[model samples]
Target: MTKVVLTVDDSRTMRDMLRLALAEASFEVVQAVDGVHGLEVLSQTEPDVIITDINMPNMDGFGFIEAVRRDERRRGTPILVLTTESDAAKKQRARAAGATGWIVKPFDPAKLVDAVRRVAA
Candidate 1:
């Protein structure tokens, strides 16, 4: 089955890039503008994986991960943090909140897709 992927980011460009990359990898892509929007989208679709940015308005990635982990249905879903932030503290925090993996922004499309495949598999 083709995997469904939810990408949450405030930047239109980032979301577009992610859409293209994931779509090319044969994954169906769902987009959200921020963490709040992400959760709303999550309620409507059962995505196999979630890719999120750390610095979105309304709710940041850490909070988003925590919220997803709290939800019983989505708690096991793999969440990959895609952001420009490379701070070790932030990465640690995201992991603490239940992120499955982290990818630096300006990501390599193939690597991103591979990471998704590994986690979603």
Candidate 2:
């Protein structure tokens, strides 16, 4: 099966950047505007992995991961948080919320691809 990836962020440019990078690595990208919408997408799309931004309207990354972990079908899905904040506390919160890994933004295209490949596999 073709591996699918969910990219959740409020910014269209960030989603585009992720699409370009992950597509080069042979994964299909599905974009979502926020955590609430991300969950809706997950129901229909069933991505192999999820990459989400922490601060978003409607719902944030922490809420998204919590919801994902609560659902048995999505409990094991790999969730990688890509964000601008580098605060240790935020990272700890994400780790506690069940995030598989993290990538700090101003996203390095190379690191983004490598991180996705590493976690999604």
Taken over the whole model, the C-alpha lDDT of each candidate is 0.96, 0.91
lDDT of 2 by residue, 9-86 (tens): 999989998999989888888999999999999889989899999999999999999998999988889999999999
| Per-residue lDDT of 108 in model 1 | 99
Mark the regions of model 1 whose C-alpha exceeds 4 Å error after superposition. Answer: none
Number of the top TM-score candidate: 1
| Candidate 2: 10-residue stretch with minimal lDDT | 112-121
* Ten-residue region with minimum lDDT total, candidate 1: 56-65
Number of the top lDDT candidate: 1
> Backbone collision count in every prediction?
0, 0
Instruction: Score every model by TM-score.
Output: 0.99, 0.96
lDDT of 1 by residue, 27-84 (tens): 9999999999999999999999999999989999999999999999988999999999
**Candidate 2: where is the Cα deviation over 4 Å?**
none
| Cα-lDDT of candidate 2 | 0.91
